[model samples]
Target: MQGFEWHVPADQLHWKRLQKALPSLRDIGVDRMWIPPGCKGMDASGIGYDVYDLWDLGEFHQKGSRATRWGPKEHLSEMMQTAQDVGIGICWDTILNHKAGADRTETFQATKVNPEDRNAAISPPENISGWVRFDFSGRKGKYSSMKYHHQHFNGVDWNETRKETAIYKIAGARKDWAKDVSDEHGNYDYLMFANLDHTNPEVRADIFKWSEWIGTELPISGMRIDAAKHYSAAFQRDFVNHLRRTTFVGNHDTQPGQSLETIIIPFFKPIAYGLILLRSQGQPCVFYGDLYGLRGGPASLSRPACSGKLPILMQARKLYAYGEQRDYFDKRHCIGFVRYGTVHYSWGLACVISNTVATYKRMYVGVKHMGEEWTDILDWCIETVIIDHRGYGIFPVAAKSISVWVNDKAKGRKSLARPFDTDIYDL
Candidate 1:
């Protein structure tokens, strides 16, 4: 689940809030959380997008505060440790496209480019002053001693001297817009603020060093690159490769024996969520807004919590939905499949999904044990299905919904109980 929303309360002590809710989140089958950016932004209330200092991370007294919008360094560390103790992994939101709130302004030769087409230079190359120098005096070169200058970046949108707002492409030798970026606006490499020139070796080395430092400092399982399209793809690949080789970071083969399969379906409704989670494909993820309602947005724009539907589906995924599969995709609107459980997890299930009218499908669940009684674990369909001697059962699903039918006497049926029920796991 995403640990925070766009408008989560600025002073909510969100790190501690998530740490407190870790156990409950784990209980609902949330193994990892894609948390907001942990690095210090432009200010205390900055939501990490105004990337000021990556190395600070609420540690140094920079950006008008010692802590980011979420919390201080100590709280973030505590939260990460808590998540680790509770067997939940953290996916840090990494911002690498640009830097904001520079320590000082520096004079550099830059050419004003057309906003619609950055390749078309509108003005001649002239000396323009912009906030392009970052000494990070607060950090005092603790984690990384390398400071940033205009040569380290490709462009800036603002010229401090002229007080103008236009796409000013920083002009220097080997300082053109990166070619390995999106071709929009002629060249989309220059995004916002001091856009880091991935082509610069110093910039690449400093970012790689910060990536390693953050990975080792925090107990993070992975990173979600922010504004990835605005940077060099080659640099991103090399950064990941460097992390894999230098430290236990990145989403590659860092874990010894575990293969991570994540399928993040953002802003999916309950039915869509059911179709994905109750299947035999990739590991499905639950949206935080769906699982625990959204807050702080406009009242009409806010969404109430999904009415106790996701926990059941998540529980089903965790306890059952295993083994060999059989697919019945004869109809366009209706489809079904069966998982013939393995020896270790032998409480196989049959799933029927329909996007239109209510329907049923006859699917085989293996003829090994043919006389088992099956019922919808979702409790959406009250009817019970009986497997015939051929191991085929007619499973019923409601209109525009799904039904996950499992053996009525499945060994772990008790553990598939709904969340917040008093007698959950007592079935």
Candidate 2:
């Protein structure tokens, strides 16, 4: 699950907050947390995307502060350690396409390219001053001795000499925009700030070295590559290959007793969420903003907390969404499915979703579950569903809602029983 939202308050000491929330997150069946970028950005308030120093993860006294927007280095380390202790793996959000907040400016020959079509040059090659040099004085070459110069980058947006903002492709040997990148805006190799030239051997080596350093420094299980479309796909592939061959980071080798395959449903509303979560197929991911609500955005754009219903669905997914699956996709406005419990779980669930008005669906639970009493676990319908001798029952769902029907006598049903539910166990 995504651990943080885009609008999370910067002053909340979010690392510590996440550390405290690890236990509860695990309880809701989150095995991994995709965290935001931790590296120091251009400034203390700048999000990690505005990359200044990759090595300074809120550690060195750089970018006008000793700590990143999240928290200090110690807090991030502690949070990562806590997540590991609680059996939750951390997926770091990595930014590698561009670098921002350069230490100094340098004059270099560059050709002005049309913003709409980057391949089409608008002006002849001329000397233009741009912030393409990074000395990283605060780090003092602690983790890496390599200093970024104009040759390491492909292009920049602002030309300080002209005091104008436009796409200026750096002019040099093999300095053309990367070929394997998004076709949008003619060539999307140069996204923003100083775009890293993956073709440069020195740049690739330094990036590889940093990747290895971060892998050893932190307990990262995987990475979510940012701005992938703007960078060379071959470079990204090589980077992953390098990680797999060198360290345990990004190593996804399945171990004994591990489930082989599952899909990830990143974001969904109530009806779509129910359709995905209550099924026996993919692993549904609950969005962080959906659970805890959102802040720091326009007041009209903020979202209210959906913790009330989400946790219930998560618990249902954990306890009963398992075993043989059967889909009922007969109706247009309504659809349903049933999961025949595995031998180990022994109690399955039936889910019905209606996009329009209130509806009912007749589905089969299992022959073994014949004549069992069933009711909606979501408490959406007040009626009961009795499995006929053939193990078929008609489940009802409210208008534009979902209903998960489980055997009334199923074990562990009492654990998820609502406070107002007196007949859940008695029946």
Candidate 3:
């Protein structure tokens, strides 16, 4: 799943269309399946993250995700199994920072509007995404899920302001000025984006229970934690520990009870395992945002699936690095020298390079791959020798022409504008 991971409302998947394309996915280098966080109201099995009813895996969708019915409860695990059948791993995103959207009667939401229970309810800092925050205290106020990352700039609602900031503007932030305020609490603020009342011991307990169940119940291989930055470090640590401890297959079965696993691999990065000390423990992780990687002119935009090119480039820093010793090798030619070996080199390098190309072409001025991306490359790594290209012409390729470069002179000067796909294997 190296290419842009397709995102859509869950219920919407045209299973037939996808079923037909199953082979194609494997054909590409996509063996990893990722389901984003908070699928509520989408074609998911139920109300996404905001409102959860874990029991009903059947017909779990609310609205607008998809018309085609896909069992909700087991959807995730099923997908994981499906992916595994096809040599893929299904990775789920957990928005542990919050619950689904607030219910009018939910204590956290009610307290925001009523204020009487503000002291007893749970809501704090502000919502992690600042899209929805409930007044757990039954009071009124604007909130962010966490405080470590600054979201306010001089009361101008920095969240809104940052949208116009250089990179933000490039990412399509439309508002020049936006105002947000919370008053007369009691689920008064709507910015938190479904804040989880972790402050509530009950809330924490419930989440732990469900997460534990999933860990032991689902057949999935891993989790992608969402809004992890918003949560307390201790809580995050404990939650992951709990997940790792749960057992998905022990006895939690349909016959009597079943389980997915006590723990699936939780590779963390900015969102999930930020609190975990990767140095001390071999914590798996993923990094976000390589906005500048697309600067490579048409290469990034027009890249074909499983192009060994990108994969080669990604593995370069570690594979090449010459004499440079570093700890990690990453995108942006970002390389880490290794006085000592690290899991980074042993494990696969996964980077998130978004497919926002409309603006990319304009910014790079035709010269891409020059901008700053997540770097591990301490040196300019050498490139792989082109081996083959698939998705070729309406006509068949000459078997003898297999190893010719994309710019091969022998192809009668007929270079492909779309380089098509190229297979990749460990070098």
Candidate 4:
């Protein structure tokens, strides 16, 4: 699911609604589900990305009671379990870069640096009031009693006493800035608020302990690591590899012209969704907004579900697309690929997607089924193609469309069985 869209006041009760939709999500061929950040944030209303307490997964009263805008701890757990029971892997979004909602402030020495060039020192190191301490007074040390101090952080943006926004590297910090971070704004390590120092052994140990603790407490299959480019690449590599988690590509941080508006531009659905589902590399994630044509406006705020081509694309992914892949991303406007099926599977799929206009492309499907016929499963093209002796066929695709041509042999097979569900979404 897309989780919360921009500026949507997603309440803690949303997970209860999701618990009811677990079976529906499985029916729609969601093998994995990406949930929003589960930790407590600056406020109950804010998304979990504004992380305040790592140990609080809607279980502490720190952020205006025991909830993190996705429902209470019990509701979140039940939803995860429900998804797991239906064979869906739960992918949790993790924020490890910066922290917010500090409980109190303290005096600390820091070096003032130029925002334009983080490495360039503008002022000599001096004592300044900083907001890097977190005690999590509400939780009462339920999960962890580890209170974060200014030493656990490398730098912060706002100067507490001056009430100003400027990047200040904490004094006695081992590293000036995190290495191998994004070059945006000179160094992207100090994103906002208290920047976690991955180099700090104590900080790293605390993170390790929290990661293990959460896994033992919750059912999580993978993680969506946030602000990955804002930390040490080596640290991230080690952490993800140690956890054995499946990582994805998308995140909230984007360039100047890369807003959600630009992403949802005209005719963007087919191309984006096609590339995601049709590829065999990483597991694809379908955004609920794109699935329901949810344009960013007042009317789209409550769009739970809507009829769209995503259902068909998901069905195609689950049923036919599999095995070894070949990419035909040679052209500018059109891209296509073929999936050679496994032995137990009856069908393989050849996909051709284009953004500009309709065109025909001759591609090889493999020599095993020389004379076999293939039909477009998505109906983007109705005409069938018969593979020649060379396993080559001319496939025509519609303009601004994603076409999936499945082997004729599997076209008549029964649709994949949906997991037995009670249809609780209506509740």
Better of 1 and 2 by TM-score: 2
Instruction: Compose the digit string of candidate 4's lDDT tens values, residues 1-427.
Output: 5543444346567687667766766766678777788899997888777899999988778867788787888998898889879988877889999899898898888989989888888999888888888989988888787889998898988888999888999888366687688988788778778999988888888887788787888888777888788898988987876565533222332211225434344456555666777678776777644443333354642342212556666777777777889888899988889888778764778888787899977899888779988887666688999999998988889887777887766853235323223232244
lDDT at 274, model 1: 64
Candidate 4's C-alpha runs over 4 A off are 1-4, 173-175, 241-261, 292-307, 324-335, 361-374, 382-394, 407-427
lDDT leader = 2
lDDT: worst 10-residue window of model 1: 250-259
Over 4 Å off in model 1, which ranges? Answer: 249-268, 298-305, 420-427
TM-score of each: 0.88, 0.90, 0.40, 0.83
lDDT (tens digit, per residue) of candidate 2 on 1-427: 7776666677728898788778767765678888888998986886688998889998899978998888899999999999999999998988999999998999999999999999999999999999989999999999999999999999999999879999999999878998899999999999999999999999999999998998889998998898899999999999999989887554111111223322222222566667667786675666665566555544532433332466667677777888888999999988988887788887999999887899899898877888888988768788989899897998999887788889888876766654321111111
**Residue 393 lDDT (model 4):** 83
Instruction: List model 1 lDDT by residue over 1-427, tens digit each.
Output: 7776555668828787787777877876778888988888877797798888899878888867887888899999999999999999998989999999888999999999998898999999999999988988989989889889999998999999989999999988877887888999998888899998888888888898888888889989988898888888888899888878865544221111224523323323456776677677876656555565455544532443335667777777767767787888899999887777778888888888887898899998878658988988778899989999997888898887778888888875766664543111121
Better of 2 and 4 by lDDT: 2
Alpha-carbon deviation at 158 in model 3, angstroms: 19
lDDT of 2: 0.81
For all candidates in order, the CA lDDT equals 0.79, 0.81, 0.30, 0.75
Q: How many residue pairs clash in each candidate?
A: 0, 0, 90, 1
Name the regions of candidate 3 deviating beyond 4 angstroms.
2-11, 14-31, 42-58, 61-78, 103-191, 248-427
